[model samples]
Target: MNTIKTIYLILCIFAISFLSRFWMSEWKWYAQFLRLKLKSKEEPDVGFDNKRDADPNKILQEADDIYQLISSTKPLFDIPPFERSTSAHNSKYYIMNPTEVHSTGNLLYTYVETYDYQGNRKTTGGDFFRARIYDKKTLTAAVGSITDFNNGSYLVTFPLYWEGTVYISIKLQYSSEMVSLIHRLRDIDNYRMGFRGIFLSKNYKEMTKCHFNLTFTGPLCDLYYHNSGIKWMCEKPKNLSCENLSSLEYYFNEPSLSEAEKKFDDRKNVLKEIRPVGASSVIVKKQGSNINLPKCQSHPLTYTNSTGFVQNHTWISSLCQVKRFRTSERVIQCIKGKKIYLVGDSTIRQWFEYLVKIIPTLSKVNVGRNQWYSEKLAVDLTNNIYLQWRTHGLPWHPGVPLMLPDSPSAVSLINNIYGGKEFITVICLGAHFTRYPLKVYLETLIHVRNAVKRLLGRSPDTTVILKNGNTRTPYKLLLDNDWLTYELNQAFVAAFMGMNVSLVDAWDLTAAYESAELHPSEEVIKNEVDVLFSYICPNID
Candidate 1:
């Protein structure tokens, strides 16, 4: 009788353990159904929808228990956008340390005074002022650093590099008032852009709208993609259940800001060049040897006072020796028998397009073409070369419909990669995420950072590069301003600071080249890729 009792007890324990495993396996579907109940009227209570996006444990961690690793700006001005929109036309600058002739090794400063479009002398400062010192004859250029006093004054500092007829160009992109408003708008208009939801069943198929906020008056489906902590909801099909929901699509809608609000963003009046009362150009003589650094090798890319500058349209990096791989033979010889993955916005896609355009041996695979946000692949089979470029996950507004099932964050892609010495991954993310909340972008960085850590731990030889955001035309206003990109770049720098990744200072590269374009000229992109090749074929002669 005792032996019989023991056997029964063991059997009961075994059955319970088996059932527990099954319960966890159904956690997602069961949890969704349990929380969702069709009721008498108001939108179904999907309060747990947010919780569903991230793991319960992850939510606690995402509460941010780790050490604070990112540094960013919080715009100081709180006045309305139109109330004190800065006017570059009314701003003026004069030399701080005036001298007959400037010496190469010294630093010089210029002070600026700002005024509002209303002609009121501004008392607080948030002017996005940019300055550059360049000499055209020698083809020498460098980006200057600006210091804002928050008291309606700015100090522009220039380091004399190559001497001889250097012109100072100062551009006041946006005043503090407009920048503060732009910052506020980002937090307020999270759903200014909308998305499409597609669902299907055996005998029923339906298409409806999906978004962070829904207006439909009926049943809704809580959508979750693989392991991503993003909240999305769609209208349930009239005939089919929530389980039939399939994919999501994203695109731009009309601007959410009112005409009154639009007054703050006067694109036509943006980024006026300001000149000094006295001389705007200076004469300088040579001091140092341009700080010629060692060739770009497998080492991490670091930044100096002059991270890099444009000389005769060539990017000279103080951090590494940047080599120009201008021809196909040079590129193919260096990258043959390798796999290159480029991921990010259209800006990064330029790299993919550049490679295929220049390398005659490289023919694009049938992955599709000319779409801004499509996944692309090109191959040079003879040399065993593989290249692919895909846009980063959501918050992405591809002009055309993007299949949601295929959309993935850099973190998702990195997590799935098992790399070798020949495997190279270049990631550039920021322009797309600027419109969302800071928390969302931070969450993305944390996930990507962790994913990168895992990837390196698994494959120590794999190369990972993080390209920072750069200057863009200020005329694009609220969403496409450089100030927003600057904040994102700051967070990016801090998150990837200590990793084994190469942080290309694209900010310096584009600005030094004086490219106000988000998609800079081909020569600029070519120089950018040369920086990439500096890594792939490090220290190449």
Candidate 2:
């Protein structure tokens, strides 16, 4: 009888202990949730007027005039004058000083010098230059930095990634071109810039004179100008625009000049002579070398973290493993029983488009032709998975159809989400707001942060990811250049600090690549998606 009584007592104590631990865990989670909620409440409220004062017609006209100026391919400024030296000079105008071969994960430096037509040294302090290293065997490439000393010298550094012989290429930016870039980065009212290149269809190649403004959004250029007040459309071409657009090589090619003209060698004269000539090769040893490579880790954002290196190509995250859902079955398995909400700009739309193409059964049901901001959905009924995409509220490009009353803001969308282990939400915003004041972007982000905090509070198990803006190729007329995007990305990182959200550092990934494309190439997008999936399924390989 005593043994039975003792057993009962022991069982009673065990039950109480188990309950105590479970309740304690719940209490801690609740405390964190409450803290986040209070922090969100403390954020300042931001509001925007629904009515805009600008006329779309005038903007479109200005865009047309700017397009004509850029297409003419004329120099925007006069060349600088340079005096020819009587003494003999180095025949090689520019010399690339080579550095020792490096292994994977090591930093390699390549130095360059700028000289005039007479072989006299020239200063490129104000000029912008970019360097790239191309792997000979894989044909893959990585971008490098060119730090100018205001003298005749510049230092270029590359983070060695691949093995084998690597060829280096340097592209220099003219001072006049630098002015346009600076304006695009700083000036909020500059609507004349931002068109990178025109897209052309094989069948409609005859349409050369097209005016592009904020309202143009079709894949093919349309002739209708009555309603929009713009005759030409800077359409997003269905096929690759590489063939229709002018190549970088053509823009930066060495200009042919008379012998007498070459002898003068002023700034104007030197500009014609200066070009990115071929340089010596640098070898990168294989990945298994004895060199101690730094392991990539995510650091918490703090006030003291330096923003200077945000644009640097060297700070790449190595933790991202390549993930490919090559088959529809694999995608279905990964996304099954999950609800995903993708909110942001056309860049996020790219992800939606990629999935639609890969998954044969995932058909897009068109909500309406005029409803560009409407919710787009793709469902796999058998797996019970739901995917949705919607544009975030206001300051979006005029190209997007105005939102309906039913449309929700990013904050509202996040708040509406019944977050759970099965829910994933991605927020991406930047390119559209580059032309607006910096304060506007920050206000929007604060509201978004509040919404995210509230959602996480309600459903602590929910996953939220933020995709930062990517780099765009440097084009004089392109308003949404890389420098502006880089600054906006910095603002984005700042706004989301101390929040429980995952950041896919697209800026670093995009800048590190050989291509400075606004809409990065498929290889880059694939890597981004893979990184995203890594967060979604960390337990998977």
Candidate 3:
């Protein structure tokens, strides 16, 4: 009987252990479900109708905690480590077809003048300000933040605050209609249509006695900084300073100044606007320390009179031709000692960077940053072939600093001088200027085409490849129910005379098979890179 009891006890213990394990798992699952339910409430709902257009960034941000945990275990799978190195190099391609759902109006412009602790002009270091803007309307396509303005300065004020000696400046580019709103606001008219919300960067949060001029005056005018939101009651002042005010209370009180005085005060602090200086200083991994200027290996191509300021040239002795869509080795051999180039706005930088990333490390690369001009990256080949990446003559987009043609910014001269080198040059110039009226397009392209003509002289052999707009997703559809890709391409292509330069259809190469329906997929990138290699180094099989 004792032996039987022992056996029965062992069986009972085993059964209890099994039951406890099962119950523990169920409890854990229940806890997970509850957490997910709570999270769903806080996270923004990504469009599920089509997964292709969903934003991976938003999804990743939501699951940040999990990423942190996994990151600690295996650094590779974690987002933080992967992001740090890549983010610096990450850039958008020119072919990105973004839809402008919001009205194209320059609605808001807030200019702030900086003063030091001694009440002198603080022009050397940086200044800080609070700023906020909202997307009043829902945008189907990906919305981009107005990161840096080309008004000439790179220091930007943010809406959020961070610890440290971060100095900030505010710059923006909207539409001319938006700029008009500021004028009306200063006149004491309706202000609702102008700036939607406020934005402030970390740089402003740490400042002490800061004085600035509020350029826009409106019926519902108020000054907000940190937790202090002050409504001004006095008549519009021409100039205002936070320096005299003993506390935040003074900014709330209406200034006892006249309109003319206010205008003068506002003008005193305003300096020249800032512009997007492009990538600051880029360090090519194994190639060199820093680039001095945009330079490349010059390929010899014939100068033909094209519609633009570039020349068209091809290999005199051919290697091979396209056969059943398959490239022959002979065709590859013909492209020896030739270099191609792409120059345009930030979006074009994306396409250019992607090409740079894939090229074999054995190839030579150079990266440079200039204070007055755009960032540059140049690659040299074993042969005399050299390729250059530079952006010049970007037309002003409203709310953003006007890309003044006179402001040491024009590609016409550079292209002409560079043309002396006998080589193929493929140029990409689009976006970065829709805010300017149609006249801006005509004027800008005329200079561009003229530069091409001056460089190519008069020849058919020089190939001036013009790229079309990239494909976009339906989510990017705007109020007009049309994509800017079609419009932008039409405008640019129409401005060009195709006789001398050839147009390489990039829309198909970059965005043909993207599930996002906007940015190119990895596969698409590979294909585009392949095409670029074929054009630049046709001799390499």
Candidate 4:
């Protein structure tokens, strides 16, 4: 009888465990369903029904039209007739000398001259130009420095990295827009131009007296600041300095325009190819294979050890001791049983696009009119892995439809997710918010923080990653610029400090490249995604 009792007890224990597991799984699904139902009721339908054009050619044509509009309207100041020069007017524009480059670790020199349609060199210095050196074989680029002499002449310097055929590319900058950027840089209180931090002091006098540091050290003040200025008076208990502050002089800098220009230019500004007048190619000879390239390690942020930045190029992270999944099979294994939710603007959408391209079986779900803000699900049933991309609520760009029902807030979306060790959340914001006040962005971030906190309170093992906004070439029609995004990125970092989250540091990754673009090249995106994968599956090889 005792032996029979023992067998019954064991069976009862197993039954209870199985029932509990089943209940939890059902609860998660039910919770998500309830939230979706509530959100649908809260958001009113806009009564507009439209579907995105599915024809690839039509999409491409529409993209070209947009690019043309952006490029044609980019110039804040009209090009003076005297500054106009045709390709046929060879003497009107020229590279003064043969491009000279060192084998390695040396600055290459390139001089450019601009002339009127009459072929006379213009003496005024307000014209802007950019330069870059591209490896012929790989097409990889290194952005060159252009120092305007203000005498219709400019000097270009390129950093040598490898031995190969190098092609030079250059572009012109609008003078009026450059001046506006300069003025914005000089204003300390401009939210888009200046740095921001969090100060917790209850003492009103000290808070009012804080001042900004003016030196190089001041820029580094993101993590460290002097106590003497009004900027230094924040309380010590939870004070956190901004990360990745930009110097006032950084506003004037312009990097090369590469594939990003061609990719982002929705309308072809000029029917003809826009090529630099005096194009030249030079061969870079390899110095030594052992030449030491810089390596970046993670640096801890103030207030939390949960996140950090790599002092080296973010690309290096993929090649270093960091583990990477080189095959689809490996990637499947790494992400098995995990669900990833990517939230933000089109930039984050790029990441989703890349994953779809790489994973063959990951198919898109067609939701008709709900496609814009609808969740795109890519499922690998064999691995039980699911990936989703959703647009954040509000401040939608004009490019997106205006009549669609509002999507759930990022915070709300995050809170509703069944977060745990198996869940990953990635978020990026700023490009759309550039036109709004800084306070608006801050309020949005605060809401996100609270949501993140709630998520952690429920599932401390959930991994959250934030991507910083990238820099972009200056365009007057588009109010977004690298400097403005820099401030926004800083605020993003400050808002999440001390939280249990990691940062992808897209700002530094984009800045390190020769091309500083809002949407960086595929190589850069690949690296960014790799860095994210490193966090998601840190032990994967």
User: What lDDT does candidate 3 reach at residue 315?
Assistant: 12
**Pick by TM-score: 1 or 2, better one:** 1
**Highest lDDT model number:** 1
Give each prediction's root-mean-square deviation over alpha carbons: 19.4, 19.8, 26.4, 25.8
Ranking by TM-score: 1, 2, 4, 3
Model 1: residues >4 Å from true position, as ranges?
1-83, 201-205, 212-228, 232-238, 241-247, 251-260, 288-290, 297-306, 368-370, 474-476
Best of the two (1, 2) by lDDT:
1
Give per-residue CA lDDT, model 4, range 1-541, as digits (tens). 5654554455355544533544464454435434432332345322111232223343334334322321221332223332343212322222333344447554455555555446666575544343456654564555555454545655565665545676766655333234233323323223332222233324411111112333333223322221100222212222333321211111212322234232222222211222444446667777755444233222222221112122223354322234455457767767889899998877787888788788887776764344544566677777777888876755454333322233445766776798899998888877866654444565566556556666766787888888878767646322455545655775676555445577776765564464556677877787788778877776664
Candidate 1 lDDT over residue span 41-155, tens digit each: 1453222232332444554344242213222234444455564667887777766544546787676666677887777888886677778888888888998876655578766
Q: Alpha-carbon error at 126 in model 2, in Å? A: 6.5
Q: Which regions in candidate 2 have their CA more than 4 angstroms from the true location?
A: 1-99, 112-128, 145-155, 173-181, 188-279, 287-317, 368-371, 398-401, 473-478, 497-499, 508-524
Candidate 3 per-residue lDDT over residues 457-522, each given as its tens digit: 543345555555555433311111112343345445544433244444444333222123344554
Alpha carbon lDDT at 243, candidate 2: 47
TM-score of 2: 0.58
Best by TM-score: 1
In the range 1-541, model 2's lDDT, one tens digit per residue, is 5654554455455544433543464454435434432443345322121121023443333334322321222222333432322111221212232334567776565555565446666653444444566654564566665444545555566666667787665654333233333433344333433333343355553222222344555554432311112232344455555346321010111333345434332332111222433335766788664444332222332222111111222332443333555567877777878888998877777788788888887878776444445678888787877788977755444343232332446766776798999999999988776664444465566557656766776787888888989877534223445545655775676566556667777765665564567677766676667666656765554
lDDT of 2 at 42: 45
Candidate 1, residue 523: how far the Cα is off, in Å: 0.8
Model 4 whole-model lDDT (C-alpha atoms): 0.51
What's the TM-score of every candidate structure? 0.80, 0.58, 0.35, 0.48
